[model samples]
Target: MPLPNTSIAHALDLADARHWTRQPPKRPATRLRHLLRQTTPSALALRLFAYPHTLTRWAEGDLDGLTPAQATLIEREIYRTWQPEVRRRAHQQILDHGGCVTAQLHARFAYTTRSGEFHDPRLLNVIEDLPALHARHLFDARHRDAADDELRRILADGIGEAYFFCALPPDQQQAALTISDLHLIHFHY
Candidate 1:
């Protein structure tokens, strides 16, 4: 029995995705930040296919004067030590009652884990979000950092995910398969 004529490493790198990510065109900007408030997360993911810069302000968490919708989108998209909604409610309660929920975040991540079974689909919160978390724990922070570096590359500009998925090691790619529900990874190959 012979394997098929395709490479698992070459599986999902769609051409447009590759082009958009690897060589983002230099384009003049005008009111691009406004685009975020008007776009849904899913639509924004596809829009990154042609215009990755349109997401800059939102991705950078520069929502200073942006509308509530834009800020909410950022809150929903990024992981902090805790969910912003829960934090906000706790803060509000403290303003009124002078006491609030407490938390200590030595680290926060965008991780997922699963059962030992190869086909498991449940996402277990563990460790990830390299840049945001400084690769704290659950990452080979020492040396020969192959897996962590690979994950960082996939998350580099946000647009590289689909194009980079197949390039991950088998176990990592398998883990990614369960994360499409979060819209962070997709199997377009």
Candidate 2:
């Protein structure tokens, strides 16, 4: 299928190349036992994208420390397990939405909550609620005063007005939009 997004495609490619040349440990049975003892399916699934090599080590029963190449291979194997049509449709949806934050959040929620079921109606309900959930998350992250009536009034009034940010009182503006140092650096660029 065509690449979903340039960055994801590049990362996948790099992972594949790294996995191809990895060597197994000499004592395979012992390594496998060690890995299996430590692994749980849920943990494996969650780490599949970010730490593919760790999963590969468990799968291969490899006691040797993970190498960069092994991680790449693990990523390719994870990708191989995905249903091609589902992945293609998901990619298209992200692309269609211009890869906005909301689109990415939806994709993440879908991936993290996936079970053996396909297109479960309950899943759609969760997706429909994600925007409000995300907005609340942002609010919670920015301000510690979620329970304050004054804060609620400020948000209710400010959000509906033009120049919403500018309309906020100085203290309310700081409370509502105070992103962390990490985000400041990210947004700066």
lDDT of each: 0.32, 0.33
**Candidate 2 local lDDT, 1-189, one digit each (tens):** 433332322232232233333333324333333334556545553644435455555556564665654454344434433333443444344335644222120110111111231222221111111233333332343234133233323322322222224455655443232111110000000
Model 2 pairs in collision = 15-72, 18-69, 19-73, 32-61
Instruction: Specify the poorest-scoring 10-residue window by lDDT in model 1.
Output: 7-16
**lDDT by residue for model 1 over 21-140, one digit each (tens)?**
122212212223334455554565462443345456434554344554543334322222113344344334433453321111111123333544333355432222222222222122
lDDT of 2 at 21: 35
Backbone collisions counted per model: 1, 4
Residue 74 accuracy (lDDT) in model 2:
44
